[model samples]
Target: MASPALPGREPGAGPRVEDLVQEVKRLRAEVEQLRVESAQLQRAVASHAVVDQAIGVLVMTAKINPEDGFMVLREISQHTNTKLSLIAEQIIKHAQDAALPETILAELHAALARRR
Candidate 1:
C-alpha cells in the first residue's frame, strides 16, 4: 500500500524539522560537555604547573634533585594528610613570603633529611 507524505514534507525530502531539532539539541549538549571537560583540563594544567614550580623551589632550597624534591613533597602531604597540590602552593608561598606554618616547616625539614 502506498502512504501519503507528511503535510509539508515531500516523499523524498530531507529529514523532518523534528529530527533536525533533536540533532541540534544533541550537538548543543555535546558542546556543553566539552566546555566542562576543557575547564577541568585547564585547572589540572595550572595545578601541575604549581607543583612543578614547588619542586624546583625544593630543588634549590633543600639542595635535592627534582625527583627527591617530589618525594619530599609527597611525604609531607602523606604525613600531614594534605593534598599534594595544596602543599605545593604553600611551598611556593613560603618561598615568596618567607612564611609557612611551623608544622609544615618541620615536616619539610624531616622529609628533606630523610632524602639525604
Candidate 2:
C-alpha cells in the first residue's frame, strides 16, 4: 500500500515533523513520570532513615535487639491504627524531648512487656 503523503514531500521520505513532535511529547511525559517516581523514592529513603533511628532508640530503651525493636514499633502502630513512619517519628521525638502521647506510651509499654 502507498504511504500517506505530506504536502511537498514524497511518500517514503524520512520521518515527518509531526512524528518528531509526538516523540518529543512522549519523552517529556516519560521524564515527568520518572521525576515523580524519583521524588517518591527519596521520601521513602528519608522515612526509612527516621524509622531506623527510632528502632535504635527502642533497642536501647528496651534492652532488645533491632528486630525486636521493629516488632515493638509495628505492634504499637498496628494497635493505634497509625502509620509506621509516623509512629517511628513520634518515638524519635520522644527520645529527644521525653514527651509522647499517653495512648502511644501505653501501647508501647504493652508491646514491650509482651516481648519480655
Candidate 3:
C-alpha cells in the first residue's frame, strides 16, 4: 500500500516525502558543518592571539620580527624535539611574568642550537 501524505506537505512541493526528509537531513548536516567551522575559527583566533603575544614577547625582549620569532620558536621545537605549543606557552608566560631568567634563555638558545 502507498504511504499516506504527511501533514503540511503539498503533493507538488518539489519533492516526495523521502526526498523532503533527505533534504531536511542534508540541511541539518550543513548547519552542523557550519557550526564546526565556526568553532574551528574561534579556536584559530584564540591560538593566533596566544602565538601573537608570544611573538611580541620575542620581538620586544629578543629583538626579532614576528616572522623570525615564529621561526626561532619552531627551530627550538625541532632542535629539542618539544612541541611548539609548550614553547609558545613558555614565551607567553615569560612575557606575563617579566622574570624569565637570562640563564634559562641562554640555555634555551643553546639547546635550540643543539650545543647541549
Quick one: best TM-score, which candidate?
2
Query: For this target, which candidate reaches the highest lDDT against the unseen true structure?
Result: 2
Which 10-residue window of candidate 2 scores lowest in summed lDDT? Answer: 3-12
In angstroms, how far off is 113's CA in candidate 1? 1.3
Q: Please identify which of the two predictions, 1 or 2, would achieve the higher TM-score against the true structure.
A: 2
* Ranking, lDDT, top scorer first: 2, 1, 3
Candidate lDDT scores, in order, read 0.92, 0.94, 0.72
TM-score of 3: 0.69
- Tens-digit per-residue lDDT, 1-116, candidate 2: 88678879788787878999999999999999999999999999999998999999999988999999999999999999999999999999998987889999999999999998
Q: lDDT (0-100) at residue 20 of candidate 2? A: 94
RMSD of each: 3.3, 3.8, 4.6
Report the lDDT of model 1 for residue 66. Answer: 95
Where is the poorest 10-residue window by lDDT in model 3?
A: 107-116
